[model samples]
Target: MSKAPFLLGAAFVAIVTGLSSIFIVDERDQVLVLQFGQVKQEVTEPGLGFKLPFIQDVVSYEDRILGLQTQPLEVTLSDNRRLIVDAFARWRIDNLIDFREAVGAGGVDAAQARLGSVVSAAIREILGSVPLNAVTSDDRTALMNRIRDIAGREAASLGVEVIDLRLTRTDLPDQNLAATFARMRAERQREAADEIARGNEAASRVRAAADRSVVEVTSDAKRQAEVIRGEADAKRNAIYADAFGKDPEFFAFTRSLTAYERALKSGNSSIVMSPDSEFFDYLRDAQGPQQQ
Candidate 1:
């Protein structure tokens, strides 16, 4: 019975040994087999892998690209402008052996931390040499590419390759926001004042032109009325002259009658004159003062 217990324990240990000696590598992972903390085999492809049981072990790292987001960093531009900047990067391990050697036991996490420092230094170096407008303008793309190139060189030592780096956010600091907004508002107000002044000038010109037109029209109408009135007076005087030329006695008789009618229009009218006055000649006889 003691021998039976010993045999069962041996079988269990053998099964455990077989299980430990075998490993399965997924397509998404790159594994390193280590013996006494030294890398023995680098399994880059997906397959069944084998290692010495109880003496060798495997460490797997992600083979695909990884992403990292940096904390907001303040940068002073060449124009003496301070900006808050946040950036992100895409990276992947290019040399598993070098990556493992550099990061040691900390692996991907340690590599990411070191990569972040390199990226930050590059960001400061490139952005510090340019003005604020360069960072905010279309030239921003070219600037970022420069940063990536600088960061990529430094990252090569850590066996990390920077696929891409981009500035995720660029903004004014909280302390400068109000000042910038105030300056923009003042500029807009100045432009609005200029537009209003221009509009007023245009309106004054229109009003002046309209007033001039009104004066010209009034003067023309008054001149035309006077000309018509002068023409009518000339026609009436000409008609009177022709009638007087036709019969001087008849014209005198008619004029005297018109004067008498006006002088005695009202029943209570009184006139102080001599009895043989020319005014009474028309009443005395049908013949006028010419006969007298």
Candidate 2:
């Protein structure tokens, strides 16, 4: 029984020593072994790793792409427009040795702080050179490309690569937006008024043209009717003149008889007859009582 207790104690010690020396590194991680506050080895491959029993320390970092989202920043354009710009960037550690040397295992937070400075500087420099319209228009793509190039170059010294840079949103301050909307509304109203004035002018021109056409048509019709009536009157006068020229005495005699018949048809009339009267002569010739 005394030997059994001694053997169990020895077995427990062996198991503890083995467990303390063995370390596991996952596929998604990079392990750094430190001995006495100095870097001993950097194990990046996924496998079972061994270390000094209780003398070494292990620190692991992610081996995947890192995401950095910055707080919204207020930037001003050359044209004096103020806007809040929200942005994000994708980055990855390209040289683990350089990253470890520079940042000292702070990992994402250290990388983010360094990257944020570069991003902010590049954004300010580019945005200061452009007007507000260019920043908000389709030209924004070109601006973002320029920003990416500059940011990547800046981050290269930190052993990092900027995979992508994006501006998530660009917006005006609330106070400025209300003022801009008011100005836009006023400009639209002025344009509408100008269009209405032009329409009224065109309508007036059409109405005046119609009135002139009516006058011209009526005058032409009246002139044509007058010409036709004048022609008919002239033809009747010509016929009468030609007939009178052929027989003047017969025409005179018929006219005198017509006058006598018209005078006698008045039933209340009384006539004093004279021998030399033309009326008496016409009556005597008709009756065949005297030859004159």
Candidate 3:
């Protein structure tokens, strides 16, 4: 009966041992097998793994690219401009042996803390040297490359390789935002004023040109009318001279009748003058007795 219980206990022990001796390393993880806190094996590939039961433990970190973001850091540019910059870095553990020794069981947290210091230092050094315009412009690519270089050099000690470094956000500090807006608004208003002034100047010039065109057109019309009137007067004078040269007495009679018609054409018209008046010369001549 005692042998039966012992045999059952033996099977139980074997089952437990089998379970504890086996572990798995995931495809996304890099595992370091630590025996009593000392690294014994580094498992980078994914599959089933084994270790001494009850004596060894496993620590894992991501073998793929990992992102570590830094809190907002303030930097002063060469032009004395203050900027708040937040950046992130893409990194992975390259030297697993060194990582195990330095980070121990803290894993990604310890690595991130150490890496953040390096990145912050790099940002201050490279970003602080350039002007704000450079950081805000296309030249920022070169600046990021330089920051990555500096950060990568410092990260090597922690068995980390920074593949990429980027500034996620860069902006003026909170206190400066209102001032920046005010300056921009003022600049826009100034430009608007200048545009209004230019438009007014152009309109004035157009109005002056139109007024001058009106004067020129009016003067030309008046001159043309005077020339037509003068031509009509000259034609009438020539006709009268021709008529008088052809027949003197008939021309004089026609002139006398025209003057009498003007003086007495209306019903209310009256001439309070003697019959011998020149105005009646034509009537008097018509009424004279017959002569040879």
Candidate whose TM-score is highest: 3
Q: Please give the TM-score that candidate 1 achieves against the real structure.
A: 0.77
lDDT of each: 0.92, 0.84, 0.89
Model 2, TM vs. native? 0.66
Candidate 2 off by > 4 Å? 1-11, 201-292
Stretches of candidate 3 above 4 Å error?
A: 1-7, 228-292
Arrange candidates by lDDT, highest first: which order? 1, 3, 2
**How would you encode candidate 1's per-residue C-alpha lDDT over 1-292 as one tens digit per residue?**
3699999999999999999999999999999999999999999999999999999999999999999888889999999999999799999999999999999999989998999899999999999999988998965789999999999999999898999999998899999999989998999999999999999999999999999999999999999999999999999999999989899887887888789778888788678999998679878876455532
lDDT of 2 by residue, 128-170 (tens): 7888888888657788878888999999888788898888878
lDDT by residue (190-240, candidate 3, tens digit) is 999999999999999999999999999999999999999999999999998
- The C-alpha RMSD of each candidate to the native structure, in angstroms, is 4.3, 7.2, 4.2
Which candidate order results from sorting by TM-score in descending order? Answer: 3, 1, 2
**Which candidate comes out best when scored by lDDT?**
1
Pairs clashing in candidate 2? none
